[model samples]
Target: MANLDTALKDAMSIDGAIGVALVDYTSGMTLGVAGGTPEIDLTVAAAGNTDVVRAKMRTIEMLKLNDDIEDMLITLGGQYHIIRPLTGPTGKGLFLYLMLSKARSNLALARHQLRTIEEQLEL
Candidate 1:
């Protein structure tokens, strides 16, 4: 399994990855982060996304949906934001947040890569 640093580096290797972070939604804290520019602060972005995750989860619970979320996607004019909650034994309560340049990224491949990263990540 890959450690946090390696996982983050792996994430950064994606075609258009601008930044990535492992965040704890429950506490809105960033456990690890990599590859952010001056225009984007990965830590702050990760923390803000905690609200997105929490809100969706709460909505799901209130609606009594039996299904679990695979991931959440937020598409911007020039960017794509992906929030994938970890499903592995060691990943409980944590999520992988990735930001990509839409023009350079392939959504399908990015999703697949994130899944693979999730599986190998050791927390």
Candidate 2:
């Protein structure tokens, strides 16, 4: 099983990965971070994405969807942001946030890779 540091390094190995973080949506705080460019402050980005996760979860509850969010995607001109709320007991209220370069990333593959990383993560 991979520990937090290993999981983060695994994420950075993904093609086009610009940054990755483990964030707590409940408190909008980051537990770990990796691979951010100088132009991107991963800590701040992770914190902001916390709101995105919380909002979606709230909407799901309000709508009585009887479902869980597997992932949330936000597309920008040059970037793709992926927020995947962790499902493991130790990961409740926490998520993996990934930022990829749109030009270089294969969205499907990145998602799949991230899922694999999540599965192996020991938290």
Candidate 3:
């Protein structure tokens, strides 16, 4: 299995990848980050997204839906933001956030690649 550093590097290699981060929703902290530009702050983005995750989770609970989230996608005019909540025991309360250029990325392939990386990630 790959460690955090390797996983982050692998994520950065995805076509059109701009930034990625491993974040803990429980505490809104970034455990690792890579490939952010001057205009994009990975840490801030990750922390901010914690609220989104939590909100979705709460909505699910309130609605009494017995389900789990795989990922959430945000489409901007020029970018695609992918937020994948980890499901492994060791990954509890954690997620991987990836940013990609809409013009350069193939969304389906990027999601598949991210899933593979998540499977191999070792904390």
Candidate that scores best on TM-score: 3
Q: Provide TM-scores for the models.
A: 0.97, 0.97, 0.98
lDDT of 3 at 104: 99
lDDT of 3 by residue, 34-94 (tens): 9999988888998899999999999999999989889999999999999999877789899
Error of 3 at 15 (Å): 0.4
RMSD to native for every prediction? 0.8, 0.8, 0.6
Residue clash pairs of candidate 2 = none
**Candidate 1 structure quality by residue, lDDT tens digits, 97-118:** 9999999999999999998998
Q: Which regions of candidate 1 fall more than 4 Å away from where they truly are? A: none
Q: Using lDDT as the measure, name the better of candidate 1 and candidate 2.
A: 1
Model 2 per-residue lDDT at 78: 96
How many clashes in each candidate? 0, 0, 0
Native-to-model Cα distance after best TM-score fit, residue 80 in candidate 3, in Å: 0.4
Q: Candidate 2: list runs displaced more than 4 Å.
A: none
